[model samples]
Target: MRTWYEGAIRGFGMLVLLSGVGLAGATAARAASLDPAMLPKIQAATFEVVQAKPTGDTLSYERPLPLELLPYQERTDKYYSIGTAFAIGHNRYVTAGHVLLAGEASLWGPPELRDAAGRVYPIGKIEKFSLGKDFVVFTLAQPPAGDAALEVDASPALNQVVYAVGNALGTGVVIRDGLYTSDTPEQENGAWKWMRFSAAASPGNSGGPLLDKDGKLIGVVLMKSANENLNYALPIHEVLDAPSGNAEMESRIAYQLDLFDTVENSQLKARFALPVGLGDFYREFQSRIDANSDAQLKALLARESANLFPSGAGSARLLHQQTQLDGFPTLIVRGSDGEWRRAGGQAQRFALDGNGYVATGAVANNGLVRLRRPDGVAAATFYGDAKSRMDLLARTGMFQRAVAGEKVKITSLGKPVRESTHLDRWRRPWHVAVWPLPYANALVMAYSLPVPDGSVMLVRFTPPAHEHDTMLDLAEISSFVHVTYQGTLAQWKDFLGNPALQPATLKGIRIDFDYDHRFSYTSPRVAFSYPSTLQAVKPDNLLWLGFRFFLDGGKPVWDVGDVNVWKDTASDDHNNVNVQRYVAPPPGLDDDLSGRWRKLAEREYPYNGVARYENDLMKINAVVAPAAAGSQPSTVLYTAFYGTAGTQPQADMKGKLDLLTKDMRVTEH
Candidate 1:
């Protein structure tokens, strides 16, 4: 997904498509004689650029293979090979500016030089740089022991034989020969020119020196046209002749780098925070793994696996595998012998061998079974369901196929347990059953709960005889499983119509604000909580609701104050609550807030000891309380309405307001 300018090679072909502009035919220039004596001086001037300790993290897309297979290739700690640089002036070197700035904020580190003998010389400061021209000039703290500097030639004729020397892929310094192809104007402006060549250039060839036959430096190789041998280099005259006294260049570089840093931070926040669509979520997850170092990648994968299976009583060790099918996240569960896979794009079908077992089509694969029961039986099964009535005698044949022709009896059955949580109303119903299989010497317990759209979630538990006294709580394990429906109604109906199958969308469930911590603002005077889902307009100054109802249009509805809380009015309603705290004004300003209560006893209409005020726009409930004895009074005000004068407060708005007001308390300074 990276663009051509982003230094990724996949989009390099586009460069050739744009190469035909502003080029004209010219006669080839005569070749100059090679100076054998100058070869040693040119080689001595060339050095490999390296970053000993990189400050920025390196992000790579290629998946790493085992390095042990190639014993000769050893991994190095060096994070960046920013192409090559050579001495242009006394203790001065020049390189392609992009080699230093290509990755945005993802590229950072103090640059140094690795000479032919492996000696490192650190760069002292940046002397000059031109981002548009892709060239930089810097001085070294300690110059290498070489007095020779390549003289810059401002003009090179077309088709002149040139020598390109630089570190190729960071392997070593290499010299390649080719003809100076032509000239083209720089893309940004016609103020500068580029020397086109037919020389070979790879990633690490950037910032290297382009030398004429007489060994005079003419251009600095910057990039190669994608899908062709045509390479581009910036004339060395630009770097040598550019004004070095420009006062704003340093600040400009800092500003651009800072922008890149901000973008990287935003990307990290989106990956770990917020709800992204299915495709983006998977891509972001994979990209993180690919970018991480070996040690970091391994740790992240292990943590992800642990989240899929949490430890609890009677919990089965299920192997989980996930893949995207039809752009939706699909999950596969594997047991000892049986495994689940997609069947005809409708539902998941379990392929079980002779050792596997199944209950009725309605409650298939929902529960676990035990090989042994507490009564020392050979085999037993436990089953639970939310949809079916809790009757032990009616479902005795639930596991008839598993223990074929064997005797089994229902030992005990529990009443259906109704469950409710903060996120949903009390509608979940489930029951448990324990059965003994004498032929197999095992006990089975089945527990099930109803899922969305009239489907049942079942769990089967089979514990050993000694652990029989310590019953495994199947209800607790079932509570953690989450099922989501993504298909159309016809597809959903088709899935529900088939009792023997389940959808592949059943996997780890995510809850809003479950993984994210609340954004809390605490000062010496006050403190409160707001869901992390809200975008902070001025962080602690204002918070905006990320989503809107049908009536809200596209405008941002938000709140501002020391501590505030906002919630939807009700189910299928557009109204919401906006609570703000107002501290009592100085002695002279009390008259402006005419309806504000001075104390709890002054109000005639007080519900649960909180005063109320009503206007055409909203209903305000205020509770005046002191921060401490003899301190100024503070009023916690709860207002229920929607967007300036849009909708009336719902009938139960006061009840919801009271819940938020109860948590609002004055803090001691």
Candidate 2:
């Protein structure tokens, strides 16, 4: 069961080496004793019953024309819907990061998958989805019957006959066969390359299943090619065996809340979008599916049916208000008129006060009713406008005080906004503004303001409540500043020595970055020399520009400036302008710099401006004058890095390293 070195074929004729064993590319002969009827049974067994939705606008493939052997034969030129997904234990599934995220994300490689019944399920918990490797793991709110899920097997034989099962071009479940080609080296979104025998795969098959001859799970069907037989798959085991993150249910829920929190300093919640509140409940549900204990699953379902609300709020009212989803618990509160009510409970009071506060709470089993306070509202407001009400609640430590109190001075940490807020002309880019430090309660928010044309002013903000003592300290926040002069590793040493910046002591450091380069040149043809040969001679010579930056863990980290080569489009040329702009900032300061730059771009450019400058660095090109072209070098590029700096020199120090230069023969762009 060990994964063969020649893992399997992937990405349109691409072959890859598996992690454990090496084998020849010769295809395995079909098992002569294999039962053809088993194909459907095996297909059912090997196939993972997926319950999913499009991460975006996936093409809905048309069914095969009435008489054709192929499903999309007539629709070849048209688009088909596709999605990415994975199996959970034995009867569940998962998908890519983008699938469940809505809005602009649909443009990116979003989530796309469906259940056995052809019913699309709402993505529930995206426990582990990462752009670093272009993989995501999620669960459906409800599980579908009939089709069972597949398990992940890390090891597989090389040169094995493998088949992929997917909703190719929306033609239902299509099975394609292929060989395990190779495993991608280093880090890449298409982590493991796959190549297959059948041509059934299309863009819609990504994250599908690639099974072995015996129908045991093997890899995930991902990429495909125009040539009918070429396709790729990600090794299934690698995905399952990869690190399981520590993201918790509450944290994830809080993460979701943060997305719409309207709080100025919330980024963690914004970056990742998934169901946070119900993640744990869904996890428990998934556990039931994996164990195959239908009775236990039913028991869990009964728990789900248990009232989340208190009694006397109306038991029959709640009983008549239930809505059932296939996988998860659904309760729809309704009005006396029978129309579905969006409110949580039946007897709840709803009103928005001048302070924009709403009050609601449920009674506990102890007969004590508890009050739910709206975010950012003063506690004193619970018993009128007096602060004594808050003190009383504090002393009572009881959340169930609906009694009226005298006019009290109400206070809170600070008022929160319902709408998005921006700080114009900030000190640094907004992206890296705040970071959760080692100490609890302590936060390091950095910003950069536009200085002169070529420079930027950087600054850091620690909340006023950041007490030096550990008594109130949560996480001790720190920063690192590394600056590279123009893109050379030598800049690393230079920034390390600068007096203005100090690297944070002991803990690890990272670099964030932003860079821009522009150039122009004319074609290399002399005037009048081509007059007679105008019909045969080409006038314009292609002008090219290139750029690149080194990044690790999405953060510009180490120094590998030594990996130099001829600057091509992929390396750094006219074709790679977009790539050039994606430079990772040098350790420490890069994070802050990126954030500051993002804010600046948001303010200066505003609305959709981020799309224009999405790259970590940017490059522009134009034709140079022929005479000046000879005088000037054909290649030019810029490099930069930032590290640590700030008030708590021992903690908040971060900086950057940068440089710009030209290439004659073409080296690192």
Candidate 3:
């Protein structure tokens, strides 16, 4: 069934082999103090092997382990190959079996021979022996070096002094003295057997020669264990004493080489599976975290914990953990059996309270506070995937906008304390900010109360739109969200789970526009532009408008607008305030959008026939158009904002949309 070439390839692939080029390039200079007289022989034995990885940069191979670390050893970049080799044959050479067998496939399709000068010769013939036997024999199609071949011995005396030479983990060739100890077979993979010795070995040391007292080849050095002085070598005796009739070695080498190609191909696939964009973002985030002070970071963490409510049956808690595995933070839970497992998804919503003793959030029908400890221990029962918890929390409504210069309070068993400050919400329900905090640890439990209250507090209020003061270098672009609210502050105290807040005090505040909002809407009359490539995919007129009104310190309350305002107002005072228009329909889709303007107020209407204030309004024409082809062609338009009689006069805004036509250029408008 299998051809001779395949068999040779298989055999060659099973054992590691090094190239003479890498060995020759090793840092022999570092060993200069040992003996210059022996330098030529060491150099002569050195070789370099160039291994081309499927996706990463090629790795360079070396011979004899360098006495000192080499550039390759300290290289952080991914390499394709590992070490070097030496001249063992006219075209034939000796190298470690492990190098060839490192992966599922071999570097050489079949056994290959390399000379001290760097020429390569494919093995025309090859022979393989058992693990204890260690050595393989091969005939090269051509000679790589003209140097005379070294003799091989079938057996060498135990505890005899020997010089093992080969690329030791890509280091240059150098001699080290050690005693031949013992031979041990590996249990997991039987193909490789250990040649125990006192000499040290590195990654590039594979496929090197172990010479006896007379400089005759005895075995091929392979690896060393960190825990012990044991080293491994393949016995050269087997190659010199194989049965004359057995001749499948070369074929095996060829098959093995082919396997190397298969392995490299799989490596390429794995390399590309990672998301590069996300990786870049992560780097930026890490930089920010490193720059922040510890104290500020602690407060930021507490706020983040506040937004993420508890889920399932558990009091909410914020916990943190670090991992050996790289990348973003992950949550894990220890099972009842004491095994750490990823926490369930349902538990992620909760927050830590009462010194993190209980987890609490929006609980289901069953009353229970589910939780997981930072060390992955299950503090309470869980029923969801912990991995997706952060994702869900990041997408929360609280992070949609920033609440600045506002009075916020929280209270638990203690009195409520309030403060006036600015708060920026993340795009997700929960926010993870890099603030300054002294604690090096990750988890904490905190509670919110009415302004100035130290007790637990639940807030029930909605966010509002704040006017941009254009004269003060403030312009509200489509990319930013502005919020302003004149409302009473809500207060709640001494409660767990979800507490309720009642209107307590009126406080006026304005939040600066942040360039984080994701939604955008343009008047019908404005024109839009995009990159030429994207023009075909995204046309125009994709508008989505949403607004909210909440108590000074509250959650984002989406609108039923003007209707709610009028309903809450006293009937006698409603006429004076022109509240009748609160129930008006939303603005139309076309240029005349007065009705839509009326709906922006958070008011509600129960009956349809009511003629809300019909006489007081101005109309503006708006349109959106596509961009033409050009390097930086753009569409520009003027938009107007207006409100009812009693409201403040809205400002006029101008905008431009740009579409780049060139390839590989940044997109800007």
Candidate 4:
């Protein structure tokens, strides 16, 4: 879970939670002088927008809710506050548009209003909405019977003492007083004027009433000023005079894509008839959200098309380069010199229960987690159980459930809302699962690949409203993920047998092992079999197989390119063997590598082609596979090597290979 500082509420957007921190002045100095009847009327009209408490908590906190910070009675309430809303008469209530939008895709019960007496009222319809001005007007399904609405006064005098009333710090309605400091032009345009005041605006105060000395409503508190105590409020006239029959929302969203240092600006505007049910409005708003986001994405890409991949000199060089494929995903950036290179953070391991560890690398807008399958969990069970997989990730702290900017206990995501698979560029099948975060209007996605020991997971968040585009985008980006899969032969058997986790590209691959001392790996390009003497073939032995890209008839294809098998032990001294697909140099390459390539091709054409060498530091035995019709400038070089730890006994290379290849069968396309 992430840590949040109170004054600067990071994750909850503009819903900042400010407690009794140092204000512009002391509480006594900020108190207002209002008529005795005014406070009661103001309090009655103002209601705290909230969501009903769930029957049981899906969220568990690192510590219990800070109940000690609140009054005894409020420590355990039936509802939690979201923001403030107040009656404007005529069954219409007003609040900050963002406050209402918080409920847009939330799983928390739809936005409701709680009165000073603790009575909860349902919101009926969204009568009017405006994203640009940040104000919303809606009708209450069952407004309490009484004359609780405050009188609207559009032209309250400047420099007059006023009370900013709302659920400050979520401790009921707080009336902090200050002067109407001045008038300022709204940032978007000078089309409207905002009432600047000296009173402090807490997070829950977003849609509260700004009352004059006589209790006349002048404005609705909206935001805190960044540079000064002159907080901003939308003049009541704006919300009161918005077009009556239709709800129009227009906003200019400043958005940027992850990994690329570029921004896309787009204006989103929509209009629909008022008196519409909350559900219909939500559908319309979500539709517009996708259209606007799509425009921004397209424009972001189109603006940099010329310098993008496959277009500029940087991209051309990158395409010609052979990437080393066994690392976390990274951003391919174009340098000032027109060269492309990968950028990423080093991996850091966080220990979890059992032998499992969460190996993480920091990246923008997304998370990368490599979980070491815990010692006791069965590989087959982990791969087949979706809830169990997510529950394991929940413990990693990256998968979380939060409220009021505080991290909570997340035993599980409950269940995945959707599950599917996407085959990455290397033909590795990535299982994709999405869980809803209705409270946040977003969804958490886990794109995972099951390996021998655990899973290589790519995680990110998206608005569930944008599901279609988000899924497509996720599939496209999956091509960039880089990870390695390795474990015991027993683990591999369990991993490969799950059809739900396998993609068609992996259908042609085969891995088999038996207690009878036989082991083998097969693919469309090559098939090979060897006995235990080749490299100790046991259920517990470690094996690593990875893929690499090659130009097949000038069109690139990924196939088995590297293989490793070894008897891993507690001590550093151990024997290992591998077969690597070594590509020959292209034109203009350096001479040293060219010479090495020549020797390898020559070694393959004639002779038994077995090579062996020994030195003070290590022992080596190797051979190059014979050329075939479809074989490229790439050659398969096999090696069995063991380090001597300077003075330890060196392996008898010739003796090991003699027994290794004695019963080996090889096939090449």
- Can you tell me which runs of candidate 3 are displaced by over 4 Å? 1-46, 52-81, 84-90, 101-142, 145-147, 185-193, 240-669
TM-score of each: 0.37, 0.29, 0.31, 0.79
Superposed by TM-score, candidate 4 places the C-alpha of residue 530 at a distance from the truth, in angstroms, of 3.9
Give one digit per residue, the lDDT tens place, for model 2 in 264-288: 1111111223434234533432342
Q: Which candidate's lDDT is highest?
A: 4
Predictions in order: lDDT: 0.42, 0.30, 0.30, 0.65
**What ranking of all candidate models by lDDT puts the best one first?**
4, 1, 3, 2
Q: What global local distance difference test value does model 2 have?
A: 0.30
Order the candidate numbers by TM-score, best to worst: 4, 1, 3, 2
Model 1: runs farther than 4 Å from truth? 1-13, 16-36, 53-67, 70-73, 76-80, 102-109, 247-548, 553-669
* Number of the top-ranking candidate, with TM-score as the measure: 4
Q: What is the per-residue lDDT of model 4 for residues 189-292, given as tens digits with 9 covering 90 to 100? A: 56688788998777678788898888899998977745567787889999988887676666656555444555666566677787777778777777776666
Query: After TM-score superposition, what is the CA distance of residue 243 in candidate 3 from its true location, in Å?
Result: 6.8
lDDT of 1 at 376: 20
